[model samples]
Target: MGSNPTLSVFLNHMFQENSYEKIIQTAILTAYPRIFTDIPLSKEIFDELERIRKTESHGEITAELKVSKLAPELEARYKLVDQLLHKNNATQILEIAAGLSPRGVEWTKNPAIEYVEVELSEMARDKNKIFKALIETPPNLQLKEGNALNLKDLQKSITHFKKDRPIAVVNEGLLRYLNFDEKAIVAENVRALLKIFGGVWITPDITLQKLLQVQNKTTMPGKNQEIIQRTGRNIEKNSFKNEEEAEKFFNNLGFTVERHSLLEVIDKLTSSKKLNISQKEVKKMLEPAVVFVMKLEDSRA
Candidate 1:
């Protein structure tokens, strides 16, 4: 399918045209090679991004936000998700809003795993080209252009899955951009898929408003403001008021939630030593982040 120009224009305006946050994230991971080791395509993609648009260095961006430890926090989040996927023994995975993530590429290395990465059309096209250039496109790794809010798009991506096996639906940084209503649509869509495929939905994007308030006072004072100014998304406004509210929101949608602290995988972060980040600092950086592994409430019975 071709790129959706209307949606592209809307997202460009929302994100200040050419300043998509994922590109910055890719740049940060690319800057610290030792920390985010496995993804060989990150650097190439970052270089391509720079050629396409002007971008500030990750160091300057992190320094401005006073979140120099963001890299380690990102690394921890990525690794913890992988750990949980393995723990769940999920062989079929669907990653929504896949962005510039290297997970599909790495996971598909094991032929037994079937990975599908869903993204907006433009990014899907860009990522497809990059993947093909860096290595032979694995048959198991399919990149589909789709929106999380649209169940039809999501259903198209899963057609390749074997209905006999449970699937794992995952997303890392998608929900913060959506308002409550949009988030509910995504939840419902995932619930529908789980009902059909019998799998769990894993996401770390269930941020809390209270946590943002606390971080604004301490670890990342101006970070939220900076993000709002850049992306036009008020994350605090979009976040659940607290953990209780977050849990209730999911529970109401018929999901059973399992919270996993990002700190659980702190020991696995190689960036801590390379970046000279102390344990105290890493803990503070990760304290607010949680990866929720959610299953249909009925599935637990």
Candidate 2:
């Protein structure tokens, strides 16, 4: 697992934090669809997930409970992206900083969707090993190693897809770690991809600190603060000051944006396990988490 220099520091921090374990939980739940979501989960992948989970103690059972609490929003975001792709007649999906996400496996089940998952080399290699051991490779799902900040690397990885066909790029777990300059590079790369592929960039990245504070107070008190303090990572510095600022910033970068709250899609969530907080309280806490869909203004016009 060779580290992409640009992401090594944060990736190292994430590894230390056992954040990748959270991703494993996602894969497990995603494979056992009934556990968290109705999305189709493959048994082959679930077997692999179980194998990996046995090897690590990711804190306590409480950690998995936390993941369960957050799973709905993440799964909901994937569903929303799929809906947007269908609406736009898009055929290709590019997932940046994909981590151990099972999206490539899940989305590729639809033969029409070409899925490209980009990860830093080490994770890419490790995940590839699991894919090889567990499931046969699907024709449409491709995994490639690259840095999000490098456009040339990004283009090279997804070159199999026709530039004329619309491509929806999904970004998760990338922005929260980046500083402003790194973020600009990422935006520039996405802008370049959209310029060539004619589609949208979807992410849950444009959060505001005020909303997070309110969310923490209302529901998962001290949890968000604990993450920041433990990781020594200031999430506020990485996000827009407010929703209005987020809009203006992206507009300046040539994207016309639409925002959706994670809370809006809470109705789709159905979990068998009881959450630490009630659904209503969870909704209140998630007020700060939002999904942003951005496309080139010219493309939309």
Candidate 3:
């Protein structure tokens, strides 16, 4: 998406390497009720993924393998992002690295809000195909290809927004893959955008190292290990050392951080009932996850 050949090549390489993560996430969403049926082509995508996995893996891992509390955690994260978006009264929303998430489809149904879902080139193309095939594409929903590490790539999506209104920037599962330097670059890019169209950056992806270690060990040991091998990124290495360090990291980057516990949206998750996850289990699963709603420290908007 950039003129610089080296940068473009690097971005493409990153996308290609992590492409399977989207499929796994889509499969998780599709397996659960109230998620796949609500999103138009999610089930189809999951089925296709299953076909590919079966053919490629030779029955090593099937789509039916449950990844412990992953389904519920994802559900809670998705709902919590929406909750924080509404709470901040953000009508113009930009979701970075938005991979096959049905949030855009569902939110765009209300014409009052303008939603832009940005992803790397390949995933964006796939999402475009799904949208066009499933429904009459909503004018409010704009899908673009961009990289979070590059400000110019991110700025390209601004054309779809109303200039007079504040914009809320949201991302779910992006930051965990980045090391500290990459994260700072992303923070700077987002900070620059916030200065232009002032609004909150809502994300639940700011994970702590300890929390990630716990999840990896207990939640879905084998599955998480497989994902780690597939993606080739040490998630724990990319995570903050602790909650205080996470807050300090963002705060030092010119954003005032507000933490919203995932537990706040626990009761709203339908996956708990569908997956038969007890309240105790759900609470334990979600206890460490927090959605950070951040705004530029100096902004008066």
Candidate 4:
């Protein structure tokens, strides 16, 4: 396989239970039904996932365990995203930092919707190949190769987008790893994109919550783990201390922002799934991986 360092960096961020939930979530919400199709994971992807279940290829131990929760995990995300799309009547899905996900293919089933998937140059090519080979994602579902930090690169891709309808952008599982300067620029670029193409979409985590697993502690490789593990690039999250700081900063950028905890969002999703688990367990899980889905008060904001 080709080397994709930025994709690699984001993937490591989700290499734990708290982190991996976002992976399960984005995959389910964006790709699940649209890409895999036929429910319960079509034969091929299911088999691949089954193989992954028995192998060490997925990630660390916690990641594997998190993968085991796929059904409920996916269910939780799908439940929320569908509601969001329905409530907002969005016409397109724009997923950034959307590293290696099946959602692009999954959501293509909706004739009215289109997906604009953006990623690092290396991953965009590989993912485009995997996604294109799996199924025809429609002229609507398009993939672009570029750097997330580079607006010109992102806009080159966006320029091709048929922006005649409402759009939803999922900055899921992003933000925490960016340095303050990079974060400011990216958030601004995204805001500019939203303003340029008006509509409501959600980017849940803004406080840039640090990954923490309670009770049982598993050491997940942090951002620079790749480099520390080998002679790799040292990319890490230069973060703000709390949600207030993130909001205060993001608000100044001109978008009307709202912040919610992972607990609040998960409870909403879990209730939709009707999963049986004590508040204690929920609390435990949310402590490490809290989720929040925000609606842009004004896409133009």
**In candidate 1, which residue ranges exceed 4 Å CA deviation?**
1-41, 51-68, 214-221
Better of 1 and 4 by TM-score: 1
Clashing pairs in 2: 1-122
lDDT of 3 by residue, 1-301 (tens): 0112244444654667554344334333324333422334556654544455467563533443545357677777888898888899989999998876778877888999899987777668756766665667788889998877778888988776777799999988887866566677788889999988888899998887666765776656565556556567667677887789899888888899999888998878776776677888778778888899999999845
Task: Give the per-residue Cα lDDT of candidate 2 at 58.
Answer: 35
Q: Which of candidates 2 and 4 is the stronger one according to lDDT?
A: 2
Give me the runs in candidate 4 sitting further than 4 Å from their true place.
1-82, 207-237, 264-279, 287-301
Total clashes for model 4: 11
> lDDT per model, in order?
0.75, 0.66, 0.73, 0.51
Query: TM-scores across all candidates?
Result: 0.82, 0.77, 0.83, 0.64
Number of clashes in every candidate structure?
0, 1, 0, 11
In model 1, the Cα lDDT at residue 290 comes to 87
What's the CA error at residue 16 for candidate 1, in Å? Answer: 15
RMSD of each: 6.1, 5.8, 5.0, 8.4
lDDT of 4 by residue, 118-177 (tens): 876655664555554456558877888765666677677766566666567776545554
Checking candidate 1 for backbone clashes, the offending pairs are none
Q: Which stretches of candidate 2 lie over 4 Å from their true place?
A: 1-35, 42-50, 53-66, 218-220, 229-232, 272-277
lDDT of 1 by residue, 1-301 (tens): 1112244444544566543333334333323342333334655664554444343242233335234445676677788999999999999999998777788888999999999998877678767766665678789999998878778999999898999999999988778876676677788889999999998999988787755765687555777787767566777788887777888888988999999998998888777786787888878778878889999999997
Best by TM-score: 3
Top-lDDT candidate index:
1
